[model samples]
Target: MLWIPATLAAAAAQTARNATQRRLTETIGTAGATQVRFLYGFPFALVFLSIALTLSGERLPRPDGGFFAFVVAGAVAQILATALMLAAMRERSFAVVTAYVKTEPVQTALVGLLILSDPVTPGGLAAILVATAGVIVMSGVGRGAGASWRPALLGLAAGAFFALSAIGFRGAILALDSGGTLIRASTTLAWGLGLQTLILTAWLLALDRPALTGSLRAWRPSIAAGFLGALASQFWFLGFALTTAANVRTLALVEVLMAQAVSRRLFAQGTSGREWLGLVLVTGGVGALLWFHA
Candidate 1:
């Protein structure tokens, strides 16, 4: 399915974005780094929406109350999730935090089922559990620095928020009355970014002016992070448009593997034998998911 490739692309871009934001967080603080994604990313999202509209030859989908509600919920939840994710990264290795966040698929499956009526077949549920187990294994739960409960809790909280965001975004996409999948997904991405940018901008301006100004002063790297963030969100929304959020999120667990690469290259973190074993499980679980969905 198109969603498969879209999810993969999203995962790759997101890993890059996370690496960039991780660097930014050191200088700008967590709030500033969090807002960098939305503020810088909003314009790029507009560009993506325009391209999708032109390619699809579709008008902008008119939003009703349902669209606004869903988009707002997604926007807020994602803001919280990003902040928590970055905070957790401050305490743990990049790969570990990535593995922690990958736990969202199960939460996403449940939330998507309850909130959006998105069904998860028994096979899909089993695959999700297996993939999630791989994440726990990779994270080396109860071992080493990762055993610290503070970062673990932050990561888990981030996963829960991410789950809510995925469900909200999928609901928003499905709520659209007109336009093809590409256009609808693009439209939703634009709205979600706009809302997030506004909310974070206001918060920064009001309470964290230094962090806000810090992000502005680092415009060069901020632009790079923004582009990557927008790229990730574009494909993520595309996947959500094509299938249930659970399927998209489960496929997205591949990001942990990608993040491991980033961690080794950028953070100088090495994988253990246990992590390698977990890698096989993640691969198997993702393979099983793809087969089941197919």
Candidate 2:
């Protein structure tokens, strides 16, 4: 029951953040908007981390060499994922893109089992299969929206990167021996976000000065989106620490339904029959996971 509400709240918050990101993407382009999210939000995360450290009376852990390496690897994977996802957003609906991204739960579970040696039960595998089918249904694989294989491929790559990011953060959390749960999670998030900011800022400056300059000029909106993104990530990291990454990410699929709602209200895009079916499948899959875990 505790996991139920916590997961639902995280999912809701993430959906709102993604909606803000989608709006920013429209104005600045995906890559530029992602850079804005990290650059503008880094300070807020730093402030939060500082407060957390002070209150907890804990010094930042000296991350093990391997831990820092994992963090960098995760950061790189996330950057690549964000780039691909932004590009995919140009050609795909937010709902479709998000639905595809939810496949990360499956990928993460597999990677966790293979690399981290996390065990998976039969029920978990069943839930993953159901959820994957829902993603396929929502993707309009056979229906005609002029959807090509390219967007799906990019979305899958995004999911893979997201899986790597999860594993990296989890590894970091395991490495830390100091601080309470909240403090540890917050510290890891601060470093991860900080690394992402550095990498993305450099990437933007090198490849697209105009977009970076434009994003800076639109600081008001950019900052708002950035704050939401940071806050959303904070909750997500906490959830990751408390639960299995597979479970947390599987529940995060609710973001797709939330995105669909946003599209209907904000863009006047109605949900299609196929999308409704997909929703039913996704809901059932989530229910199954919860039931089995319970």
Candidate 3:
């Protein structure tokens, strides 16, 4: 499926966005940096939606209760997930934090099965496990860092919330029968970001004006991160629309590899032999997944 490429591109773009956002988080609070992805990103998402509609010549699918329910759930869950991730990052090392977050693929698979009735074959299940193993190792779960309940629970909860967000968005897109997959994905992205922006803006207006102002003041970097955030999400939605959320998220584990490469090239960090082994397993798992689909 074209979702394979889409997922790969999303992973790379998302890694860049994460790096940008991480820097921004140092200047602005985590909430503000997190809000940037939704607030500034909505405009780019709108642009994507426009292009998709223009190319497909499809009318905007009117949102019914089911559509809004899913979108709203996804939006809220996504925000909570970000907050939890920020909190986890504060409490633990990046590798430990990411190890917890990487649990999302497995959680996504289970949630997709239970809520979306998406089925995975035994081979598909095996592929997911293999890929997840690679991701866990890459995340430094092998470092044995989940020692405390606080950070561990925070990370696990964040992963679950992220899983819920994926499932919600996937359900929302599939509920829209009036458009092509591109149209469906774009529409979902636009609405989800819009809702997230509104909610986060309202929160900042009421409670943390400085963080909000800080985000606005840091417009240049914020915009770059926002644009990439939107771009990554656009492709993420496309993949979700084309296949099961489990499959999409499983392949999405390669994001860690992409980020690791960036660290190596940009930060001069070295990868260990174990990391290379993890990469090989991820590659093999991806091949197995593709074969299973075929």
Candidate 4:
């Protein structure tokens, strides 16, 4: 379905947006860089919502307490996940960090079942486990020059929060009582980004004024990254509205291969034999998931 391609597009956009944000982190610092996505993304999210409303002729759904709970949970968990990931980046290589965060498929399944009552088929569960094992094999846990548990802890925490964010966003999207999936997804995006913008802006203003100014000075690239971030989130929410969060997340394991391809093309890096094997396993697992589910 469209959710499959939509999720694929989100993964690619997220990779590109993160590359831009990595450069931003060097200038504005991590927290400020994280804020850029919210600050700049909110306007684009509003635009998306406006377009969806006009096209669908749907009024905004009246949000209930569950909607607010889910949205706030998604917003706060994502922010914390970003922060922890940035912190882990300081301690681990990008490959290791991403692999750690990729554990979200398993966690997402558990969270979705627990909180949203989303059910996973037996085949789907098998695919998730196989893909997760491949990801762990690819992580190269001891391949680092020197290792510490700090980054590992941070990475796992980031993965858990990310899982929470996925469940929360899916919950938020499903909580809507009216509108098409597109309209509901767009509406959730608008509210989520708006709340995140307010929260991060207030924090930056109170504690990190210089970083805010630095982001302002680098507005050109910041806006580019921000726009891409919003674009990715839009499609992500749409995917959530269309399918279970666990399925969306399991398919998203493709991003690991995407990141490797990006690094090879842009940074003159290459994967090893073990990584290739891992790629094979992940591909096989994901292929089986789609095949069985189809």
How many clashing residue pairs appear in each of the predictions shown? 0, 0, 0, 0
Question: Over 4 Å off in model 3, which ranges?
Answer: 90-96, 140-153, 267-269
lDDT of 2 by residue, 251-276 (tens): 77777788899878876777888989
The lDDT of model 3 is: 0.84
Query: On a 0 to 1 TM-score scale, where does candidate 1 land against the true structure?
Result: 0.98
What is the per-residue lDDT of model 4 for residues 129-155, given as tens digits with 9 covering 90 to 100? 988887777766556556566787788
Q: Give the TM-score of candidate 3.
A: 0.91
lDDT of 2: 0.78
TM-score for all models, in order of appearance: 0.98, 0.93, 0.91, 0.95
Worst 10 residues of 1 by lDDT: 138-147
Candidate 1 residues lying further than 4 Å off, grouped into runs, are 144-147
Candidate numbers sorted by lDDT from highest down: 1, 4, 3, 2
Clashing pairs in 4: none
Write one digit per residue (lDDT tens) for candidate 3, span 1-294: 899999999988888887777678779978899899888999999999999999999999877889999999999999998878767766665544555676787789898999899998899999988877775665554355446667777777888999999999999998886888999999999999999999999999999999999999999999998999999999999999999998888888777667667666655667777767777777778778889987
Quantify all predictions' global Cα lDDT against the true fold: 0.93, 0.78, 0.84, 0.86
Clashing pairs in 2: none
